[model samples]
Target: MTRKILLLSVSAGAGHVRAAEAIRASAALSGEALEVRHLDVMDYVPAGFRKLYADTYLKLVAKLPALWGYLYQSSHEAKPDSTTEKIRRSVERLSTRPLRKEIAAFAPDAIVCTHFLPAEMLDRMLRQGDLACPVWVQVTDFDLHRMWVHEHMRGYFAANEEVAFRMRAAGIPATNIHVTGIPIMPVFGEMLERQICAAEYGLDPARTTVLLMGGGAGMGSLDTVAQSLLQIGGDFQLIVLAGRNVAALEALQTLAAQHPGRLVALGFTDKVERLMSCADLVITKPGGLSTSECLAKGLPMILNAPIPGQEERNADYLLEQGVALKACDAVTLEYRVRLLLENPAKLADMRNKARALGRPDAGKQVLKTVLGQ
Candidate 1:
């Protein structure tokens, strides 16, 4: 029988949406008789609410990280039925009526949520008997937060065993939790020739290459990091990806012109896999999707300025696993990069550790488990 699957996510951050897209891509590549739909819950909300919902998070994380971190911790500790929780849930329910209608119309055999927003709503629907299909939640970070948990969820997907262990400690049955790793797009699983990828980007394959990224919104001291890297005396080149930040891109382009072959500045592009293929190391934020992509490519990372909360937790896991080093500032980032550059054995060991942790086929594993095929 053909199966119907609905993958849900919110645009609060790029990881959740990217995780859903990864599963969709995996389904397409599987050549199964399955129907799949990926929905962003934010799309159904009112324009004002949608803007506020997404923008507030970005603003809080960027401008008031300490406050954001405190809120994150407090919310996790708060009881699910606390007055604040109820008020928040009430507001979400009122804004997401259209989403329920859409889900009813689709009538999926299985529902997967990459973000907690829709998962929480659907959990309510399930308890109220409005939704009959099983709803599975995929935690899109190395750490599991309370928001991703629900009493009636059929199962949970985790990025690592530690998250799975946390799920178990949270009273979720071990059988109901699966450590599938965070899903990444199928392209990262493919093998690409480093020389070819380097040539495609007008880079020299023989030179040590470093890639720097600041998530999808370009939210870090990228210019300072790039300049600091340039000051290091080494036979190496740098590639900086300034995603969706025009001002940053312009600044990087200006910097690139000053150094010619030593630097490559790029704006948003879909060819990140190619760049990863050509690089020896990556200096990036520890977003789940980006880190999973780096792991898939066996690219060791110097994790930089991770936003407090989930990202900080992610850096903790990566560092414990020996695949990454955390750099709290530009000076630390430069020092870490220089240390690795001078220590080829350490870089190689990190790369090997990354490869061991990389679950490039996580998307396939997710689909197979969800569909019971």
Candidate 2:
């Protein structure tokens, strides 16, 4: 019998949607009898509410990150009492009407939720006896947030053992959690030679290359980082991936024009893996998907200005792993980059640690665990 797998993801961040897409691709390559489908949870919601859900989140993170951080912590610390349960039920029913309809039509044998919103809704449905399929929640962060927890989930996938330990501490049973590093496209795991990638990308193979990515929305201070890099004296070139942010892209392009051969500014490109292959170091915000891709490539990282809540936690985990440095300001970022350039040994050490921590085959691992194969 062919197994039907529904991957539910939300677009609050690009990571969740990308993780679902990665898992779908992996399932296709697995040679198992499976039918997999990936759905953006927002697609099912009414347009007005959908726009509000996504746009509000982006505005909050971009404009008022501190408030977002405060809400993130407060929600987690709140006790799950009877009133909490009542409020949860009300919110679940209101928000999950579209999802409820989706489940009926899809009739999946197993449901994998890559985002917390769908997981919370699906978990509530299961508890209320509205849905019966086994639920697997993939926590796509290095650190576990309380929002991602649900006692009814059949399994929980975590990025590392430390996160798994935190899951257990959150009152989830040990047997229900699996330490499968966040799923990334298998392309990142490919061992492509840097020289060849540089040649393909028209970069000088002799010069050290730095990649600065601001996630899909281009939400970070890439211009500030670029300015800092220009002040450093080294045999290094800069590549800025200003994803989906035209303003940032234009600003970077203007900067690139000043330093002809030393800088490259890209708008949004599907060639992130190729770019990563050519980069020795990455200066990026601590988003789960981007960091996981960097780790898979064994590239050293300097985390820059992580958002207050989940990103801060992700930055902390990367620091603990010895694979990354946190630089919240342009001055600190410049100093860290220069220090790494002056000391090749430290950069190499970070690369080695990243390789140790990376799970290149995480997609396959997630499939194997969920399917019991």
lDDT by residue (tens digit), candidate 1, 9-121: 99987899999999999999999999999999999999988988998999999899888899889999999879999999999999999999999999999999999999999
**TM-score for all models, in order of appearance:** 0.99, 0.96
**How much lDDT does candidate 2 score?**
0.89
TM-score of 1: 0.99
Worst lDDT run of 10 residues, candidate 2, spans 84-93
For every candidate, C-alpha RMSD to the true structure in Å: 0.8, 1.5
| Residue ranges of candidate 2 with Cα displaced over 4 Å | 82-85
**Per-candidate clash tally:** 0, 0
User: Per-residue lDDT of 252-289 in model 2, one digit per residue for the tens?
Assistant: 98998888888989988877999998899999989999
